[model samples]
Target: MSTYLTILGYNSAIPTVNASPTAQFLDMEERAFLIDCGEGTQVQLRKAKVRFSKINHIFISHLHGDHCFGLPGLIASFRLLGRDTALNVYGPKGIKEMMETIFRLTETHKGFEVIYHELKSKSSEKIYEDSRIEVFTIPLDHRIYCNGYLFREKPKERHLNMKEISKYPEIQTCDYHHIKSGRDFELSDGYVLKNSILTTDPTDPISYAFCSDTRYWEEVIPLIENVDVLYHESTFLHDLKEMADHTGHTTALEAARIARKANVGKLILGHFSNRYSDLSVFTDEAREVFPNTFLPKALEAVKIG
Candidate 1:
């Protein structure tokens, strides 16, 4: 199964010549999930070559314009494309009212069902789940009712040893299911073969945590501990830490510190302030604390094991 993250836009607050707002596309096991539908997100999606019809679910971190402004436009575009599949949108409370107001004012009618899942809990909770992955809400310490998302791959089934299965002519193709399910096999003579002898251990599950538009919040460490990849917002550098704290946003140093504390495998810093023309400074500052930090470019896809 293929799993990766496509960063469409990473800028904070507004769109600029060099940067846009917060938007991302996560491809997990071929399933598409839109993270934050910032302004011009649909354009970014087109630039990323993402199929609009594949994105059935969208997770909005907050009601900020930079974070969710493109949602209505994207939904309307979906209707224009003649999409029939139901779309599920997960976001904080008041999102339904906000979207409904936009639809009412624009007189736009959706040809497909749009399901809104409102999030209100302060604690961590599972908001979405499928056969292969699960998404949870990470309560953030932002000025508004913001949230982060944690995407975790479910435990995979063990791999079947084809050579071992071929050794027994009696083992039919249908019985491979039982072997992959970690069940022992019995022969006509009552001889039993252990499941371990027929199958190899499955690969470890992977996890990705998305933390944006928040302050230096340490309470989330336990929930995101040891994740495979962590995309944390570094809205400012350490030099502007005072402003970061006042605005309820994290600096590059603070984001790196959280990654170090959480012991995540990789740390991706984004949601940069447009004031700084050069973004390498953010990477330089973050690397001072966490050496595994990375500053991803727009449309870059980072592979996760």
Candidate 2:
């Protein structure tokens, strides 16, 4: 039941005194997922007090240096820390070769295992499916081979009402599945118990999307519409709108526009450019278009609820 998102880094292209590059940690239940390992991501994780050992998966949005430059260091650190768990890395093609070369040159032998899942940059697909959640790829409009990730919680079965079910002594215990499925229970005396009177609807599953270092692409609207939380890259403010578009980055206002169009519950704007000394402009500009917008600070944890 413990689910939260921690911002490891929020700067773009460069590191500042108060922020690093792009990185985030998604914690759900007993596992954690790392999103975009920028420079010094491992250090940020330590400062945030995140249990890095629990991270079994890493998702890279693109091959951009600001987005994934710290991956090699993190992998090395994992080995130095004596990790024995297998780590799965999901990203666009060439990532495997990139990591392989880094390891080959440094003669770094991992104590565990590393699996690379090359994602298609052109299409959307169900990349990972598990009992608790499903992860899908979201094609993004970026200069390099890139894609986003969408996390959706799986549906859960209904909770049985033990008190009400205990009253029906004649009802067979073998038919519990049927009773949980909303079927009425029949007794030996021709009495019946209504399912609606005993059971209630389960909690609705929540979803979150991560899109980094991309331009304003409307194609993502259908896939991420009405998501519980959306973390979009806002590398520049409106003052540098033309520069942002030319560099294949988004402005704060543009990010907010996408969240508004998608009707997401909350919008988290990150990947800020280092030219700006203050971040108030980013928040104010995004809030102009979408009121439920927030600017994440480095190592700050944001809950979707």
Candidate 3:
């Protein structure tokens, strides 16, 4: 299945009245993942027409209110919805304490389970893996500990070439599974048929990287290189780059530079400072360096790769 990304919110802190904060929903290989649950994210999810029960995994970037304030409310809502399945949440080391405190103070109870995976690693590491997909952490530079996630689809099985297989009368329908798995076939006469002759290459896999609330760091370039799509925070304009550096945030131009250096297929600029009235200015600046740069549209489902 194809990969889809829905941007739920893409704004900075202190002024959420104008727009929503950082939040996103990713559907990769038919798996649902929530990235950074800011305040009012559940409302955004409903507006996006996403089923809350489908989200089994959540990845929080940092401890900042703009990135994690909505998590507790969402979990509470899940309990109210009578969810019985376990939920997995990934975030900074202190996240568990913070979440549990709120749940305890309010005396919250749920029939379902919420498993927390707190991370303290300063280097990239694999976080989740399955038969069809693998997720890795992209260590980021921010005021507090932060991490970006890389979601990638695993390699697929080769496709069978029916015309070539037809030539071998000894081949039965039952043998198609082995042939598709890149195994060679041997006939009753001891003749061998190469797997390559019976099957063709599968479709290329898709990959997506999410880097938000980070400074202009080049270390992430290698990790996210050649990704089909990248969502990087651009909180300020190039002219105010000094302020961005002080706040550990990236400028629109710097974000484009990273995207160009990484050779990514597409670059999505987000986390706009509320000061900017015209969002096009960001695109104007970034597109100068990376022509494929785009501004984020809230609640729009975009296909990656």
Best by lDDT: 3
Better of 1 and 2 by lDDT: 1
lDDT of 2 by residue, 165-252 (tens): 7777676668777866778876777777788755666577778899987888888889899999999989889888899889888899
Estimate candidate 3's alpha-carbon lDDT, on a 0 to 1 scale.
0.94
Instruction: Using TM-score, give the best candidate's number.
Output: 3
Off by over 4 Å in 2: 170-194
lDDT of 1 at 224: 94
Cα lDDT tens digits, model 3, 127-164, are 99999999999999999999999999988889999999
lDDT of 1 by residue, 11-65 (tens): 9997997678999999998789999999999999998899999999999999989
* Runs with alpha carbons beyond 4 Å of true place in candidate 1: none
Query: What TM-score does model 2 achieve against the real structure?
Result: 0.93
Clashes of each: 0, 0, 0
What does the lDDT read for residue 58 in candidate 1? 97
What is the lDDT, from 0 to 100, of the residue 206 in candidate 1?
86
Clashes of 2: 0
Which pairs clash inside model 3?
none
